[model samples]
Target chain A: MTELVKVKNLHKSFGTLDVLKGINLTVEAGETVVLLGSSGSGKSTLLRCINFMETPTEGRVYLNGEAVGDDVNGKMRYKEADLCKLRSRIGMVFQHFNLFPHMSVLQNVMEGQITVLGRRQEEAKDKSMAQLQRVGLAEKASEYPSRLSGGQKQRVAIARALAMDPEVMLFDEVTSALDPELVGEVLKTMRQLAEEGMTMICVTHELGFAYHVANRVLFLNQGEIHEEGQPQALLKTPKTQRMREFLDGHALFKLPE
Target chain B: MEWNFAPVLGSMDILLLGLLNTLKVTGLALLFGVPLGLGLALSRLSQMRILSMVAAFIIEFFRTTPPLVQLFWFFFAFPILFGVNMTPFTTAIVTFSIQSSAFFAEIFRSGIQSIDKGQWEGSKAIGMTRNQTLRRVILPQAVKRMIPAFMERSIELLKTTTLVSTIAYTDLMYQANDIAQRTFRPLEVYTVIAVIYFLLIFVFSQLSIVVERRLAKSGEGTVH
Candidate 1:
């Protein structure tokens, strides 16, 4: 399989605190890689670094083999203009589902297409409608985001990202903030996208969704990939004490008797 | 002595003209000031050090100094510096616009900055550049938050137009002074002008409340 995303020796630090330390990763095209870690293990930071949302203090990122951020004097320097273009190819959905409160749900989905992609208004509307339909939110297009539940808002956010026609999607704890009952709808939408072969990197603690949808599970511990493998093997028989302990803490990680 | 508003009644035409001029100056100042302040606030919040510094200097200079002093300087000192004379009316517009802009800029900066950082991050995640994020997502919300502050500043600007009287610009207060001098009755003249100012300001304040309610009921910039 062709490698769609490659990170070499990624290191991110905020001030003196090291967040992601000397990491290397690769994801093939159409792969769904679920990053699992407890809080502050830097799963979110790693996901953010992939898109230059939080620029790595030291690293090289290759998206579809094209270098993201500039290689200047052996250091990465991203000009805002270049970053903006690069970001368009990689969609990200936030935990908060930060839809533009001033816009209707349809406008929220259409904004990026018209503004960044430079599509015509009519074409953008059509594409946005299709995306909204995919997420089962087409009927709510005219409603404001504030009028929707957390699940519906997240669906709209997903639709907004999908309308950009990005090559890869990064889901940052997409359903972590949702109510338990509302989580299933968002996960179902994500499952549909996965089935359609959309490349995805998800940072999430929902073992059920990860178990069902993830092609690979990457367990991060203390800013490093402590263990990683296919969902059935690695989760069923954790190779390391850290993984075992982590699984013990999250009872959902228990294998069937 | 006896009190009478007979002189104010006689000079109704001049007072009306002056009131019109006051409205003109206030309206023009608001039209120019609100946009200028938005620009200044953006500059102040910008990452570029030079833009932030320049905006800081301008905002502090205009905000700290008195509007009356600014009017006097624009009227008296500007001609000497530029080798061109300005009418008192022109001077009043320039001074108040600049001064009101400084105040409005503060309001706008706070309003924009107060927006949740997640909103900005959300726009960025959708691949919007900073300018697009601000224009489409941030400013539309910020502008709503700024309206009340804007209305307050406008009312202050309305009262401030009276200062133009010092330059003989013949605003409401200026015409009041003229009528007072003509009839030599300061008590009645000042009383009439005070009543007029109160009524005008009271009406505007009530109107602003109605506007605020409308904006709240129908979300700002929420179409369809």
Candidate 2:
């Protein structure tokens, strides 16, 4: 597979504190790479920077073999009209799902296709209904996100992003906010998406899902790459002392690889 | 230009004609005014500081001045200041609309800004432009959020109808004053006019509540 994204020495800070400092990583087409880190290690920021939702204080972000920006919101330099076109191949699903509360599940999913792609209302609705069916929520299309369970909302969110026909999906702790009982449903949907060969970068603490779904596991610590390898080796034989410390502290959960 | 309430009300034909004229001015003013107010509200939220400042200044200027004073300024002073004379009807509509727009703009601006920053980022990530989000996502949500305030503002605008009398416009209050002066029944005639104003505004308030309930029932996640 070809490399789809590359980050070099990315640094970001809010006020006096640094979140991501001198970080580097690469993602290839159709690859599901999970970033495993405790909170505040800048894993979420790294995901956000890739999508231009958060500007890196200093660094380069390359998507599809072109440097998108050095420091701008990174999204601003692209043709405003074509901005969503780029993101169509790369979707981001938040921890909360972030589905618009005022819209129905169908409208929430249909928004990008209709508003950004300029699909006709009927055409978008048809496509949205199909996407909902794929996620097994066709019956709930008319319902609001507030009425759905956490797993259902995340599934709806996954379908919403899928309606745009994106090749890569970013999951920022997609199941983090879910109840433990609800976690399995969202993970199951994600496992299904991964099996279909969609390139994804997920920031998650759920190492078991990461071990099963990810092609390569990246461990980030203090805004830098601590180590990375096939999931089993990273879990059983961490090469660095920092990776060891991370693994030692995380062993209690045995929840992450 | 003269304050002659005498014989104006006794001639029912003339009073009725004046009342008709009043509706024409008020109705047309509101028809276009509401949209303009929405536009002004959008301008107030523009990222450009100078644009927002100018919009804010315009709203504040109109909101602070007394409506009667603003009416005189638009009607009598504006023409000489700018070397143009406008009809009183034109002036009344212009002034009333301007007044209404300012309040509506501020009310709208506050409601729109209340949404979480996360919503904008979320919309942008999915590839919707600012305008698309506003129309498809933001404004629909904001409109429901603003229904109660909208009713309050409507009542204010209805009360403001009396200000047209200052410019010698023959609205309901103007007709009341005419009847009061003629029959020497200032208390009775004015009291009757107040009752009519109360009835009209009360009906409007009840209508908004019905609309609000319908909105809430439809899974809009709004109370007002």
Candidate 3:
């Protein structure tokens, strides 16, 4: 399998607080990597850095073997235009749906396609509709986000991101803000995407999703990867004490075999 | 002192002309100010330190100083300082345009800043350039929320345009002053002009209320 994303010595700092410390990772095409960590473990930051939403304080990110930013005198220098182009190829869904409130669902999905990709309006609308249909939100295309349920809004957000036809999708706790029952639909959509061979990196506390859908699971703790392996092994037999304790904290980690 | 609106009514043509001039200045100032305010707001919000500082400085300078002083400076002092002829009409337009723009800029900045940070992240994630994101995503939402504040500022601008009267511009107030002197009926003339101002401003307030209701009904301006 060809590597689609690579993170080498990735370090991120907010002022004096270091969030991500010397991390390296690689995801192959069609691979689904689930990131598991507690709050403040830098899971969201790591996902953000992958798309340059949060620039890494140190190190580099590569997509398809191409560096996201140019190296200048041992430091990464990014032009806005270049970063924008790179970001367009990496879809990200936020914890809060973040659908444009001013626009209807279809418009939200079509905005980036028409504006960023410069697709014709008619073409963008058709593509956006298809993405909405894939997420099972095609019927609600004409409705505003404020009128939709949390799950429906999230699905529209996912459609908005997917309308770009990105190479890899980054999900930053996409279901974290949903109602208990609403999370299932969103997870189902994500599972369908994974089944269809879309490369995905998800930061989630939902162990059930990680166990069932993920090809690999990485346990992150305090800015470092504490443990990582195939989901069946790592979720069941954590190598480190911290990973074991972390798993112990999550009661939902166990599922019927 | 007996009440006699005869003199005030006699100068109706001149007062109407003055009212028209008042609207002209207010409308022109709004035309120039809204776009200028948007520019200043964008500049102030820009990441470039110097540009934002410069924009901030301009906005503060115009907002802090009195509009009357600004009008006086533009009308009396500008011609001498800049070696250019200044007319009362042009002075009214220029002074209020930049002055109201300072206030409008703040309204615009607050409106734009009030949008959720997630909107910016979402737009960025989709690969939109900053300008594209702002024009497509941010401004469309911000403009709606700003309508009420914008209407308030516009009404303020209309009242502030009356300051042009001190410089001998024939606005509603100036014409009232002229009619009061000629007719020797200060009470009647001033009261008539006050009523006209009240009617004009009241109409605008009602219009703003209607627009706000429409926006609310349409499920907008509630994104926060």
Candidate 4:
């Protein structure tokens, strides 16, 4: 598989606090990589850096082998227009689902398609409806997000990203905000996407999902990846004491057989 | 003292004309002010330091100063300072439009800022340019929450328009003053004009309440 996303020694700092330091990763097309870490381990920041949502203080990100920002005097500088274009091809769903409140689900899904992709309205609507149907939310097309349950809003958010026809999808703890019962429906939709061969990078605490869906899992510690391997081996037999201690904390849920 | 309203009744046409003038100024000021306020709000929220500072200065200057003083400055001082002719009507429109816009800009800024940062991140994640996201997502949501505040500012602008009478503008207050002196019925004329102002303002307040309720029913201004 071709490397679709590559992070080269990426570093991000908010003032003096380093969120991500000396991180390197490579995600090939159709690979589902789950990021697992304790809070403040830089999992979400690493995902954000992929889309330039959080500009890296240093280093580079490559999509399909094309560097995202311009290399200027040994430092990366991004033009707004260039970053916008780059972001359009990389889909991301946030924890809050951030659907536009003024728009219906169908309109929310169609917005990026029409505005960013410059598709005709009719064509965009058709594409958006298909995505909604894919997420089993076709009936909710006309409903406002405020009227939907948490799971339904998340599904609509997923459809919104999918309608963009992105090369890769990044999910930043998309299920974290949902009520316990509502998480299954969102996970089911994500699993379906993985089975359909969409390249994905996910930052999640759902180890069951990692075991079931992720081809590989990366365990982060203090702004760096401390361990990486296939889910079955890495999760069950973590090589380091830090990974074991983290897993012990989440021992409540049984990993899927 | 015996009540006498016959003189006030005789000058109904003039009072009506003055009311019309008041409305004309209020309407024109809103038409100019709302858009100007939006411009100023956007500039103040802009990333450029110089642009935001300039916008903040304009908003602060007009908001801190008294509206009456602003009207007097435009009507009496502007023509001399600029060496141009200034009509009372023009002066009222210019002063009130900018003055009301300063207040409107604050309302708009707060409305826009009140939107969740997740909304911006969501829009950005979809690859929308900042302008596209603002025009499509942020402003639409922000404008809904701003309805009540906008109406309040508009009512304040309407009442402030009375200051134009001091410059010899033929507004309701000025006409009331004229009718009062001519007929020696200050009590009756002033009372009638006060009631007229109250009724007009009451209608606006009720209209805004209705709009706010309708917006609530439609599930707007509730999303974070």
Scored by DockQ, the top model is: 3
lDDT of 2 by residue, B64-148 (tens): 9998898899989999998987777788888888898898888788778877676787788888888888888888878877877
lDDT by residue for model 1 (A1-257), tens: 88999999999999999999988999999999999988999999999999889899998999999988777788678898888888898999999998888899999999999999999999999999999989998999999998999999999999999999898999999998999999999999999999999999999988887788999999999999999999878888889998888878887554555
Residue B99 in candidate 3 has what lDDT? Answer: 97
DockQ class, candidate 2 = medium
> What part of the reference interface contacts, as a 0 to 1 fraction, does candidate 4 reproduce?
0.88
* Cα lDDT of model 1 by residue, B1-224, tens digit: 99887777888899899899999999999899988998999999999999999999999999999898899999999999999879998898899889999998999888888788999898888789999999888988988877877887899999999999999998999999999989998899889889999999999999988888787787653210
Interface RMSD of 1: 0.7
Interface RMSDs of the predictions, in order, are 0.7, 1.5, 0.6, 0.6
Encode model 4's per-residue lDDT on A176-233: one tens digit a residue. Answer: 9999999999999999999999999999999999998999999999999999999999
**What tens-digit string does per-residue lDDT give for candidate 3 at A28-146?**
99999999999999999999999999889999999998988888889789998999999999999999988898899999999999888999999999999999999998999999999
**Residue-by-residue lDDT tens digits, candidate 2, A1-257:** 68888888889999988999888888998888999887788899999988767767888777878776333554335455555556665689998778898889999999899878889999999999998988899999999888999999999999998888876788888898889999998898888888988888999888787778889999998888888999878877889988787778866556432
Model 4 chain B poorest 10 in a row by lDDT: B215-224
Q: What would the TM-scores of all predictions be?
A: 0.96, 0.89, 0.98, 0.98
State how far residue A150 of model 3 sits from its true place (Å). 1.0
Worst 10 residues of 3 chain A by lDDT: A248-257
Better of 1 and 2 by DockQ: 1
DockQ each: 0.77, 0.55, 0.90, 0.88
- At residue A215, candidate 2 shows an lDDT of 90
Say which candidate scores most in lDDT.
4
